[model samples]
Target chain A: MSSGDHTAHVHRDDYGSRMGMWLFLFTELILFGGLFLIYAVYRFMYPTEFHVAAMELDTVFGAVNTIILLTSSLTIAMSITALQRNRKTLSLVLQFATILLAISFMVNKYFEWGAKFGYGLYPGSEMLLDKPSGEILFFGLYYTMTGLHGLHVLIGIVFIGIIMYQVWIGRVHSTNYVRLESAGLYWHLVDIIWIFLFPLFYLII
Target chain B: MANGTLYMPETEPNYLDYRGRFKGILGWILSTDHKRIGLLYLYSMGLFLTVGIFFGFMMRLELIAPGKVIIEPQTYNSFFTLHGIIMIFLFIIPGLPAVFGNFFLPILIGAKDVAFPRINLLSWWLFAIGGGLAITSVFLPGGPADTGWTFYVPYSIRSTTNVLPAAFAAFILGFSSILTGINFVTTIHRLRAPGMDWFKMPLFIWSLYATAWIQVLATPIIGITLLLVAVERLFGIGLFDPALGGDPVLFQHLFWIYSHPAVYIMILPAMGVISEIIPVFARRTIFGYSFIAFSSLAIAFFGSLVWAHHMFTAGMSDTGRFVFSLLTFLVAIPSAIKVFNWIATLYKGSIQLAPPMLYALGFIFLFSIGGLTGLMQGALSINIHIHDTSFIVGHFHYVMFGGTGFGIFAALHYWLPKMYGRMYNEKRAKVGFWVLITGFNLLYFPMLVMGWLGMPRRYYDYLPEFHVYHFISTIGSWILITGLLIMAVNLILGVRRGAKATDNPWGGETLEWRIQTPPTHENFHEIPVITGGPYEYKINENGQEEKKYEEVT
Candidate 1:
């Protein structure tokens, strides 16, 4: 009870906050789940087209971005640990590191999307790619999924920036770490989503 | 103290003091106080309800003639769409929970405030903003969305109306619902008094708990689905447009995913109200308390999976239809359990025919018919006969309006004295109830017959053979509207000059009734540690019911 209250007074009930965040994550999973179900049905119907389209994605770029996201997840986890131990400076540093890695992931994605756009692979673009019928379907899902993921990453960066400011101002301390934990949890989720995206769009044979 | 009336001098800043009346008004409008925020929701929602009822009246008037008499076809289409959107999103979903649940949940659970007061206020503001956007869309150049509230895809995408703004408004409203759910979940879990265990909490809190779960879990799907619709309209995204190789059925899947659980989100709190009213008026413990609580949860859980039943006639596969029909039938079992428990609770108890109790009885009888008719729709064979007819509309009205709407009125009447510190005229209340009930049946009952006779819904005109039923329904609508107006006036008068109410007006054992009417800012002067279950009806040595509270100090 003491530990619960101690955690609760500063963090305002981690059990509730954590449960709420998990519920949110569940909703996120279901949102993407709808898209995933669509991807499954479409891929099953047009296996050959999906494979040809998957081959167009740069695996090297996808693997590098995956590593970047995975490392950012580590940095975020370490930052949570730092905040819990009252190491404000160390936590701030780690958060910056995580943010930098996230930026690197986005930068790599930018060039890859640029290359696709240059090849006329963009949806509704004048650059007509091979196999018009199924290629449009492939690219449609591609842009929607990655574009939505990019938007999430942007939101995650903003969340981390807010936490960084709170730490800098000394508003967050060892007693108050729930926000940090929740932010870290969100950052890791963004990374995990990218992990699946890599395999589905880049690594699949 | 013994009489439970603690009056301070009128000279001082009493509980009713509007001293910072200007600031108080602004404070209520803008401040993050949960109570004030709750009242803000009440006023805003009431405004929307008035607008929605006017639209409904127009719809009824338009139906009075077989052809377009009152309004043109396009205007009629938009009118009914606006009516559906406002009544469902603005009134019914947030009706009881936002106004009543926000005001009373904390007090009933012995807490000073909801866990996240600022977020609570944010939810109300979001609702206001969303509602404003919806209303603004009505004046758009293309006119308001006539795609119906469901906004089924192929037609929705092809329609040249203001689908983007209307759908975006719905999307924004979903966030308000989600935030409120998060706030309530945290408050109920963290802020209960020392001895108020999960099972020991009032049934209202229990209903809210179930409702919050649905809001949290289900609202986001609609949020994203509506956003997809907006995106589709804006960029011609092929998510639901079949001409662009997108599947329209996917839209149905996503829409129903949220809209189905949304029905539970609307009704579960009302069920909580019925549970509270029954035990109090019947002078007994609620029969099968755990069963009732679990049934609310069961309804929430099963409600999500049965949404595909709405898509049966929309060209789903034979397998998909069969599975959804089976799941739909499964969902009814939990609702049946609740009805059975309500009946069992009334068994072997002294039943008082209070206004609230009468509404509860009305709810049971009507919801039973609603639920049973729903099972008929669940049958693929029967559905093909009655799909999209007035039967579907009549069935939902029985559940939503007859079940949830009547239940909300019951709760308002039951709690008004405790909330406003005044008693309404009992005689007038009974009269209003009977008129509303009779009119409600008269209005909707004919629709069931007309539907069976194959009268389609959402049409501006119908055949002459359907005229008698439509005429009856129109008259019934007039009667229903008048009854509602009378009830509203009665409550207003009651608030002004009625008798000052005692705390335990219904003689219930809930913690909310233990406090003075219009409770203090902190709710409890001192927090109570619960000593017994919520529906404790046992008599003490004097052969009278024991008072639950020991002492204030």
Candidate 2:
């Protein structure tokens, strides 16, 4: 490696940046963890309600969104690898593609939520359907979970956009791949969260 | 390099060169230096503490007579709610660790700076913003929040108070804490000087590491929990509002999951401080270094599980109560281990009886009593009688106030010379220590007795029988406040004109004392590798010897 390429050799102190990200992810997990626990307890209490509520959600839409997210994750992973192989232009292209895919997933989510809203399933609105207690419980989980996941998708899109800028500006390259790796880790987490979200909201029913 | 002995010069005026001092007021406001950031937290927390104390004193004055003396009952509720909120979140939660820990942890560990100094600065600013918002809630149109610090839901939902601002402030403060935790964890993991292994690291860093874990892993739940409460309050959502078929108890669970570990977040660093002070004054290796270090981690690990103990009276099942109570008792074991080890470290060593040592000793005695009382409350049957009573309040005060508060004072005194390059009056410090400890017991101990006598807490007024205890507690509070005032004044004066401190005023073997009184921009002249455990104090053929590890570089 060139002597100017300081980032290639991971400084012993570099763990701080990585560890900070890991701890942040830990906090994010716990934040989402509490909601998961709530979902678990409520689901256990009202299985039939959850089942029916799960059925009401469009599986096809969710499945499409999942595919979009998964594909974005792949692009992000490839971007990191492209940067690692000194293919800066390729990396930037991949990051842009990832951001585009993330935005598309969010667009799909907007439509899906809009359809639910049209169906009188909006939380606290007059249009909210009068369902069994279990179904209401399921809807509560649905809104809270999907709303939170949507927030994550928005955040992911922003992060990818920033990464795209960094790559375009030639700040990211093979030697300086920590940012890409960190961003990839976050993108992968978003994908992993959707893996769970898909089965719970779409497949399990 | 040169036996790995960290040496800081005495007449090094350049060491105190605050880089942003040239920027004038803006320098302090926008500076990213950890020292300045720590001072910012100190000043903000000090202001909040004063406000909290004012509210507390008002409560005490109101109780001076059987009826309300200065304010109406609604005002009284707001006063006490602000008091609890400010004291718990604004002051004590960040009390020492945010102030001294931020200032000294990196220096003590011999690193150039905290791993994330910019984030460190951001945490303090967030704290200031949160504190400002919380205080502003006092004058809002609907009056201040009256749901107390815990903010239990249905009442919180229905109460015509400015609950949103207060809850939002708390949510923001949780973010500050999480950021600080993230910074500290990374610093401890990556910033240790070469050869400063986990076991050789100062107990303070170990405690901080554990505390940071709680901040990172637990505070977010409270953030979400508070946000949900705000959403419920503002938009009429019913997540926590039990009147709308929501479960208030679920709020309790979410709150305690964070709040329970939060108690440890308050004390673990105090325990770390006491460990540091004991070894320096006792002139010996800390008894059971590994155990003390691991106990901190153990406490952090177990602290999360026992949060359910707080929910015992919230109508949990018998099996749930049984499991929680048992876990609660188990949590105290690590604490007990720490107490035992501290005493053992002091067994046959030369004890200096300095002011810091005095406070450290006070922490041991008071924290022990507090921990034991906590165990008493942890018992399923006993908690039923005293769950919402003054006894529970008393127990927490002893732990939080007596334990964390006393430990903070100990650290202030211990590090005062190092931080400011001056010596405080020994006579004044001793008097302050004794007065504070005496007044602290007087202030809180009687509430325990009255709690047992069936006196409920948070009441504006009480029956005549409870008056005697309230009067005593109030008087004691005055004395406690006076002692704190004396301590603060003397230390401030001491910093300006006191005798210049030596490189190692206490002859302590820690890396912090090895540096200048006020450390340099870069803490060390040459980064010193750790050659010994922090508390190694023994004699060998090489004059006075200590356990020395190798230098990695």
Best by DockQ: 2
- Estimate the Cα RMSD of every predicted model relative to the unseen true structure: 4.2, 4.5
DockQ of 2: 0.36
How is the predicted docking of candidate 1 categorized under the CAPRI scheme?
A: acceptable
Residue lDDT tens for model 2, B294-334? 99999999998999888878998899899999999999899
What range of 10 consecutive residues in model 1 chain A has the weakest lDDT sum?
Answer: A1-10
In the order shown, the chain A TM-scores of the predictions are 0.91, 0.90
Pairs that clash in candidate 1: none
After superposition, candidate 2 runs with Cα above 4 Å error: A1-13, B1-15, B20-22, B538-553
**Quality class of the docking in candidate 2, CAPRI style:** acceptable
Report the C-alpha lDDT of model 1 over A63-127, residue by residue, as the tens digit.
99999999999999999898888788899999999999989889998999999888677765655
For each candidate in the order shown, give its overall lDDT on alpha carbons: 0.82, 0.82
Q: What's the lDDT for candidate 2? A: 0.82
Best by TM-score: 2
